[model samples]
Target: MGGKQPVTIMTDQCSAMDKAIREVFPKSRHRLCTWHIGENAIVNIKGVMAKDGFKPRFDYVLKYTDTIAEFQHYWNSLMTDYNCKTHKWIERLYDLKEKWCPAYNKEWFSWGILSSQRSETTNHSISRRLHKTNGLCDFYKCFLDVIDEWRSKENKGDYNSSTGNRYYSCADNMLCFHARNVYTIAIYLIFEQRFIKVIGLRCQRISYEFLVSEYIVGHPTKDFIRHVVKFNEQEMVVDFTCKSYGEIGILCSHILRVFIVHNVEEIPKQYIMKRWTKEAMNTIVEEGEDRDNEEYIGGVEGDGNVSNKYVRDETLLDVIEPSIDTVLPDVVEPIVEKVIPTMIQNPPKRKRKIKNGTEKANERNMRPKGIVEKKRNKLKGWNKRRERHVDNLREETQSTDKCMYHKFTCWWGFGSSNIFKFTIGSICSR
Candidate 1:
């Protein structure tokens, strides 16, 4: 957002959007929304997709296959089996497979967001307060409202990460004690889950060295997937063949199991990705302190356009610096706290006239009396017309009622009308 391109961008299949993205963000991987493509397939090839096993097989090829070879084989087999080789939609999808297929795009970290469905959901939320007929000003205000709501949630997350502490019973038992203090609440929960899951895993040492070891790990699963873990004891580094850390920025259960087996009491600093830690955002803010502060603190030097600083802007940092200074370690916290408020707040721009009650009363009296009386007369005349209209409706209703009663009695004698009336009365009485 700050001249730093996104790793990936997902949108529905629109040629214009695709062309624009290619020109504007050529480095960013552009992905078509899987949800949109699936919906388009349903609409365009409903008959083909509804055939026995067609839909499931298509989904399996798209989502389940993990390798390019497996994906291509399954996809080709499906096309041949269904005789869908002639389908234009299928042909187009095959051409663009890497944009939507998980197997083909495994190199990019999509964060498990395979579709634009979440963006669509956010669009619906923002649109709920908007309308097609809205003017530009109204739409702009609504957009700001939606942005404010999203920013408020981000601020809440920051506040919680900075001040909140979570203590699990297992925290005292293993490296979780250190993790609870280092990671944010949501991230700590994820790490704690891996720690808890490590209990169910059984690891067998496959090879050993002075500082490196390899292990085969087993867990209960439908497919019975065995995981391989390699560890460097001296460096306290662990690697799982699954590459969970590389892909998702979190250590896998296999690595956790290895760590527990090796009695690693704390996570290595190198393995502790700052992006997942509670102080991640604050760390960026501290790093990007003003030139004066950096000079005084002897902070690292870099051109202001370093491009990778993660804080939203200096404004967010200003809002958070006060509370952060109070909570962070004394060595890292700035000694000059009072200057932050002065830097954040600006002097009043202008003055306004504050009038007493008599002056306000005189202003109100300055309005023309005739206009007020005209409004009251207009309201009274409208009420009178409504009352007259109501009276006419009542008269018409009474006439219709009388006609119905007399006609029923005359046409069907006492037997038909009276019996029908009695039945209705009995039903109502119950």
Candidate 2:
């Protein structure tokens, strides 16, 4: 009997995806992953209160909705109380009633369809592989390797390649070796293609010194693990240990060093790996694949390399910010956008202006409400806006605290007067 008992696939209950799959698999039914469905319903569909007030109502809806009548009853009550009749998410859900009501499609919907524990299980398991990575570069390499390897395993293929060619997955078992991976890398180096395929690797003169300088701008932790450079004072050989994603592999750093420091135009071949190479990327393989399209992994993935122009990481989000055309309005610079506080409309101009005799407020109490206030009310009035209109001469018995503009025939006032008198006298003589 050729039949699939069923393979459970858990994904976020995104309507676009559900709709897309719905169009393709008309006969193949889908039960919404209830936990994700609930999450989406709460986050995108309905809002649970920010405070804990919404918990009982949310729990009531979740618990009582095992059957369609119960669900509808609770839903109607909720809709009435929250004014959810006008809510777009609730309207949309009702529009797609067939997907939500279990009784409407019992063959597809069941207790197995809902998954709340899977997420918790996955989170607990993630800690088993935590706290690793020697330096940033090595961590990124291992990071890419892990993704490719996992994707390949998930797809049951070598790796997902953009190009129509096949490439084997870079074995991420290397991540397990990490700081010990150099000895393991030497073992894989015997494969010959691993290091010998590039000219920079063959020549050995690319800047082993520079890549080991640790130009990594921003990383929160891992101060002990850094760029290691052992210069051969005698033989003139350099061994640079570079780290990325928990692995410290021996890199032919000379080329990367030269390119970084000297601003060399040609990227050395020694730096070419399946991760960024077109061949590696095209085939999702450890060898001969192109992976440039995977820039989204580094750019939007929110890794910390935002400070480095060449690197993108979550902690270093600004590093990638300059690289991407963050198309803000030409008039709206990001710096200005960040610094400028949002100006709110000044409380809608009090449409019903205060009528007279409403309070103990006196006309004397509110005299044009000078832009600045002589009175010490905290709400500054228009009186604050006034600057003293300075006069030319000081009052008799000149006050010690005289305005500087009128201190003693202010030069500003007298200088112009002298010029005016001279001009007038010259004109009369003429």
Candidate 3:
């Protein structure tokens, strides 16, 4: 793709693969997969971990802390108390802590994916359509089908983001009205959870200059841990001690609680990260200045408050729609014959002649195939293509109901004009 490379790679430890990554993507950060690391731990040192109550402590060291000091203290304590300092596997994992531990890599945005489990899941998803006996054509078809399915899911996500309402379990009018309309469904849900938690949080001002605030909940729940928030009133910047936003690009409940305490009407523009928004992949097809060539421009990287410019040319509508006055040539159609289905039949027996030239004895050399060799018929007629009935899609050019052309055009953020023209054809294409 262009000159871009992966920001980070999460895979199992292998010397050859590590060397390849270093040579090809020298600037990319490579991390061991968390799942594989834990699996190896369980397989190699389960006795020590289970006997010394090390599993939960080690997991906490990996996931719970966000600072280097805390991670180091906890790790050293676990090793010393459990007598695991001499364990070869534990010592090896400790040396590579910065590669996979959350506390060490909190600054990089991994999109909340900490392991190679997602890669494994994708492999399993496409494994069913693959076989050792599959030909090249079959493999190509399988690849296209998998890609089409992925694009279909992405289109569904876009549709939900465009049409769905921002729903909250609790009544938070400010967030419900704004975040629902601004973010995609998946992202909106995450923000909604934080907003809901902000309702139960009680905030107290600790300092005025730094705008330091302490938030706590009265409930005895396991997640009722107190959080600290620091805000810069003049600069409109907020920081949470949990470091959720820094680590994953999503504002945590603590920051949202501070916002609600300060009576913030809307989310700050700088806090709305473009990578998590619904318009992350939005693009436009624009005409060049020479007016002879067309090019596709990718999504804008402007500030959240800034708007993108688009090219609108209604005269090009004919490129997509057929002209009403267009004349068609008439031709004779060819007749096609349908093939008849054949019935399964048993093979005729063959008799072999003896070497003595006497009566031949009948014998079978081949064994019948096993049931496991038979292919599944479940998907035989799935998503089959058929001839389209054009007449059913044709509508009469007459309108009886009052047209809400104005109401629909002005709906949401769309301007009450056709200045922005978009063709949705690219969404369904891979």
Candidate 4:
């Protein structure tokens, strides 16, 4: 990371790793994986887990508590009721609660990841392709294959994001339209979920000072868990107490509710993270870099007016008003006519050709089959044969129970019959 340590590092609970992180990256927050913690609980508290309602209560304490006070209250109650107050593993977990507890780690930016399960999943995939007897060269080759598969998946996602059309629940909202154009398909879906949640939320402004306003946002039924949103009217910036945007780079539902109340047309440019956008892979020029050869600015190509690309539409009136005094009336009319026509001209839409029934059937028949389809057909055939064999054995056992019983007692005298009877019994029982 360019010699800079990450803000947070998540790992399974290990004393050596904990010591190393504390020594090497003193400033970085070290987090314990919640999945590992839960897995450890199965081994450490098997007796407690066997009791009714213990698992659900444990899960609730681990995941649902949102404040330090709430966590402490529930944790103490759990320990008392479960009689695990003196349990060694539970005591150790309590000592490191800040590392694994959601309430304690909420302020940190983790990209919405609560555990290292994603890395574990990748490891599982790699392990399936590897062997204990594999050589170093074979291992390297397998690693490259895994990397290529990941890149292929990324390319497929990019293709879908670029070409796929998504249905918007709030089709009339300008903010939703702006999100659809700016964000990638996956990120847009996540944003849309938050946008849809705005319908259930209610926002009320509590204070106003200068250009800043503070609002309380929450659902009608949940008055106790309200979120505070602070909005700056001048800068068009919003801050939520949940810090969801800081952690995940996506605005929370509470902030969106505030925007709806204020009649905000589009998400502010500052809030729209470039990493989540469809143009995430586009080359970004740094400040003081040469831009003479650059053809595009703000998605517009070959535009001579560079200033307009950086300025917002609402601020254009202010800019043009000051320049009106210096501009000649004869020159202004021609400039307006030339720019207005080019700016408003819509691109021509492609005509769609409806396919007939025969044409569609032919296209389907001509489509090339892949290895996956062949494997699926082979699996289906195997399953059918197995089912038939089981049914035959079941019927034979039911019809010839007396003969099978005699064969079982006289196995030495009738070897083949004994083996057949054994097979029939096993299959029927299964």
* Candidate closest to the true structure, highest lDDT: 4
Which has the higher lDDT value, candidate number 2 or candidate number 3? Answer: 3
Indicate the worst ten consecutive residues by lDDT in candidate 2. 389-398
List, residue by residue over 1-430, the lDDT tens digit for candidate 2. Answer: 1333422233455668778666655555555555655667667744544433344454444432333543454456556556557877767767765554443443342333445466666555443444564567765665666668667664432132221222112333232122122222222222222223222221122223443422221111211111323443333333433322112122333323423334333322342333323343334334433565355345543565433534434447766678566555554686576655443423223223256736432234333432112121331232123211111111111121223222222211333224223221211222
Give the per-residue lDDT digits (tens) of candidate 1, residues 1-430: 5687888899999999999999999988899887788899899999998887677667666655544544665576678778998888888888999888876666566765778888788889878998889999998899999989999987776786676534354846658888877877667666766677788777778678787898766554311224567899887777664555654566777888888888888888876778788777676564556887665444333644422243345667888899876677664536556666676686333333345533222233333444224433454576569656644533332232223334322322233214224322211222
**After superposition, candidate 3 runs with Cα above 4 Å error:** 50-52, 170-172, 200-202, 210-226, 285-430
lDDT of all predictions: 0.66, 0.38, 0.59, 0.71
Which TM-score value belongs to model 2?
0.26
Model 3 misses residue 117 by how many Å?
1.6
Candidate 2 lDDT: 0.38
Q: How many pairs of residues collide in each model?
A: 0, 51, 0, 0
Q: Write the per-residue lDDT of candidate 3 for residues 44-98, one digit (tens) a residue.
A: 9988867745665666665555556546655666676688899898888888888
Cα displacement (Å) at residue 414, model 1: 98
Q: What C-alpha lDDT, on a 0 to 100 scale, does residue 296 get in candidate 2?
A: 37
Clashing pairs in 4: none
Give lDDT for model 3.
Answer: 0.59
Candidate 3: the clashing residue pairs are none
**Which of the predicted structures, 1 or 2, would earn the higher lDDT when compared with the native?**
1
